[model samples]
Structure formats: C-alpha cells, structure tokens
Target: MIRGDDGIRAFFAGLARDWRGWRGVRKWDTIEHDLAIKARHTGRKIRLNFTLRPGSDRDYWIVTLEMVIPPDESLDRLARDIGELFGDL
Candidate 1:
C-alpha cells in the first residue's frame, strides 16, 4: 500500500508520465480509459479510492489509499494538481 503524501504524489506523477506516453500511440483508442479516483478526507487523514477497468469485459482494478497528513501540511496544491491531471484527459 502507498503511504504518506510523497507516495501519493509519486503515484500520480508516474501515472501522468505513462499516460502522456500512451497518448502518442496510434492505437490509443484501444486503451482503456475508465479510470477514477475519489478522495475523501476525514479528520487528519485522506482516503483515495481508485477504480480502473482495463476493458469493458474485464473486472475493475480497485485500490484504497490512506494517507496521514501532518497538521502543518496543506493539500491545496495536491488538489490543484489532481484537478489539472484529470482535466488533461
């Protein structure tokens, strides 16, 4: 399981890099695009739930991510980055 804010950022950064590479392929239409990440914050923690389906006939790839946030840390930048990432899609 991914832990901490850095892990979360790295995960999304890697995903975005790979996604950009995939977009360059001519057969990109064949790639599965059904991906969703729902983030919920409760108290000092955040839970990120991810659902991805590789194909219409395939089962979903589900993941639950929980991160502990230090009181001094702010999530505004992370939220913006996530919004921009999804906006690109």
Candidate 2:
C-alpha cells in the first residue's frame, strides 16, 4: 500500500495524529529510508511498533506494524486485530 517517501511520511503523520491521546508516541528516523514508531494502544495498553522500511525495488517502501498483546487481552480480540492488520500471515 505504501509506495514511496510521500506515502511513508503521510502514514507516520496519521499515526502521530491518531495516537496523540495515547500515553506517548515515540518515533525514530533513519538518515533517508526508515522510520519506527512506538506507541501503546489507547484502551488496551498494548505496545505497538510501526516501521517503514525500504523495499527491495527502487523507490518502493514496505510497512510492518506489530503489537505486543499481553495475556490480559483476550485471544479473540488479539486474533481479530491481527487478522485485520495482516490477513493469513
């Protein structure tokens, strides 16, 4: 879904804006090609990491967003979120 630098920037911007109400949104950027966002889910308190990395091809980028769900979060809910984010992965 993410095409190039513009898409990456826009994605990070949206995450920053959307997660403002969470505890904190921390991000680290590489010189020209990578970005990492660390934040917790608002109500679930699940730790999430969103990373944007360059793709194998030129001018392409890939995004990986993962969550660390604790035992407190029900298996059903965790499964649902995972399914929504990464289908059949």
Candidate 3:
C-alpha cells in the first residue's frame, strides 16, 4: 500500500505522465485534494480519479478508473482491467 505524502505525490505524478501521453485532459472539480480527468482510449470515454483522504495519523489515497462499456465489450473484462489498473495504487 502507498504510505506517506511523498508516495502520494509520486503516484499522482506518474499517473499524469501516463495519461497525458494518452491525450487525457485534466479537470478541476469541487472535490478537495483530488485529481480528475476525462479521456478517450481506444475510442472509449474514460474517467480517472485520485482522491486523498486524511486519517488520524496519516493520509491515504484512492484511485478509480471508470469507462462506459461498448456494445462489443465484455463488462467483466472491462471491470477486471479497471480494477487492476487502479488496484496497484
């Protein structure tokens, strides 16, 4: 699991680099200390979120990957891919 503030920053930075290469556009929303983006990959609209949570002793983060399943795409496969993509963080 990711621990500490530096790890959190590094994680987001890496995500930015990867998504930027994929033509993702970042957006600022009402949420605090979070990152949101909208992008298209393989012609699919994707939403990515990195949310930060503060705890008693430390801060933590949650990563989410979302996309609409195309008629030709298997929901199970897409779900697994989304899980694996953000699960590491």
Best by lDDT: 2
State the weakest 10-residue window (summed lDDT) of model 3: 1-10
Q: Tell me the lDDT of candidate 1.
A: 0.41
Clashing pairs in 2: none
| Residue-wise C-alpha lDDT for candidate 3, range 1-89, written one tens digit per residue | 33224233333344334432355454433233344434343444334443334433334555556644332334335445545555565
- Expressed as tens digits, the lDDT of each residue in 5-57 for candidate 1 is 32434444443333322221111111244444544444444444555555565
> lDDT per model, in order?
0.41, 0.50, 0.41
**Clash pairs of candidate 3?**
none
Scanning candidate 1 in windows of ten residues, the lowest lDDT window is 22-31
Model 3 TM-score, all chains together = 0.26
In order of TM-score, best first, we have 1, 2, 3
Segments of candidate 1 deviating more than 4 angstroms: 1-33, 60-73, 86-89
Model 2, span 1-89: residue lDDT tens: 32234333443344434443444654544445465556565654446686777634535767778876543534345444534554423
Candidate 3 stretches with Cα past 4 Å from truth are: 1-23, 35-37, 41-44, 47-58, 69-89
Estimate the lDDT of model 3.
0.41
Give candidate 2's whole-model lDDT: 0.50
